[model samples]
Target: MKNTPLNLCTTRLHGGEYGLYVALRERADNVMNAETEPIYGHKPARYLLQEIAAGNKEYSELLLSKETVIGRRETGEILHELALLQTHLWKAGRVLRVRFLEGPEHVHRQIETIAKTWETHANITFDFIAQGQAEVRISFTRSGSWSLVGTDALTERDQNKATMNFDLSDETTSPDAFPATILHEFGHCLGCVHEHQSPAAAIQWNKPLIYSRLFQAYGWDRQKVDTNFFEQAEKALITNSGYDPLSIMHYSFPPEFTVPPTPTPHNTQLSAQDIAFISRCYPFPASSTASTLLKG
Candidate 1:
């Protein structure tokens, strides 16, 4: 291989063939071996995603663009050789200022009560205020729920613009729906990536079904789904405990979206592993030699 832009995966898997991203996504989740599987010639889950993302021009451009991977970084354009996963973490024991641009007082209070749960587990605090520049500026007017990963929120040049968005229309705010969605997005604020994107996860995604399902639900195309659910994290970037299917950060796909051995129900609370992972990442000081975990 010529080490072209397409061969960006550090491991250098197969040629970046065009349009195999779907099939590659399906096979990659099931196979795990030192040698590529002889069974139907399927490649390991990790190897396939890196190339498949690069294999198709559309997928490659969507994923590789600076805007896609941790946009608004202070310095360089290059994220990772392959930007499969991204996280920008804060130093332990830092206070993250949060400002809710607009929302009912009750709703804002509800968010604070739930989001503050992370503080019990990790060495961080959320300082919600009405004025002054905040690291995480939230708004409920947007159509979907999302947040910039950790410090990336700081890069938003416009102070009036929100770095985090939520859809809190009356129709969407069920008792269960609000908390689950907020917790997941706040996890991103704390520098966590989607749990499904973990390299160790190996979720056997029903690609066609997932595409159709998400398209109907959120109007996302295949590129968006692939970017969120297909590529596995590079082992080097993450400090993961073996894949935790129950993490609040993981998506709860319905049975139709995956093959057998279905995923856990929609997670509204952090799993034991989620608490442990955050604790590990931001361990309490032990005689002044406290350490930190680096993950995305």
Candidate 2:
């Protein structure tokens, strides 16, 4: 998730004040179960229809209904992210032009897959320009301490306009797995902070000492832990009750990050709640316009 398009889990800030950080999670078993609805992202047909009735347009005329999409569940969650991204584009009154740049290796192809998946869900058009130059470059600590992962981003005034470079060379990840991370980081790029880290997150933290223990086990220093873990916790402290621990933004440590209670896996895949939140947060203009037309 880090290289082609960054995911939000893998990288971390090294010894600098405002340097780049990437975060990728510990890779889970990549074998996806077709029967299991991915932890989130499935929209019930009735609900989707109800929302459409509320004023949203069905951009996906050629695509299956929400129910059919879930019943088959043939594709991965990348499609869901694309749909959500499209919703945001509609709301923001903007069009995101996605281009896949060819890199020296297969890395660029992976990035292309991530972008293309989004294009499909959002029902947007894009261009794939394969220039030989790497689409992205990896940034790291001078000490060779860390490589960019999905969870991290370099903090710079110029970072706003700069396209991030993600490092995908690490052997610990699977193809589909990285896409979720990429989606999360892209969420960050779009200005989303961690849901778990919100003020509402504290109510959901459930375990405190466990998190303490986790920090100890990983030898994760206080500063790194603050940025990666506590910052979100602090955010949770102030936010409202929509906090979902099963959120892809959450980490796997049990109650508190202590005794590894019940390994509540951090869903790398988007959840239904996440999809709804994205739809509301970022509805595409056409979708919004259609929604308004329906209301009127």
Give the number of the best model, judged by lDDT: 1
lDDT of each: 0.61, 0.39
Candidate 1 on 160-198: residue-level lDDT in tens? 878787777522357866777778788878777777778
Q: If scored against the real structure, what TM-score would every candidate get?
A: 0.67, 0.48
Kindly list the per-residue Cα lDDT of model 2 for residues 181-246, writing each as its tens digit: 555554444334566566665533334453455355445555665665556432212224477766
Candidate RMSDs in Å, in order, are: 14.7, 17.7
Which pairs of residues collide in model 1?
28-45
lDDT of 1: 0.61
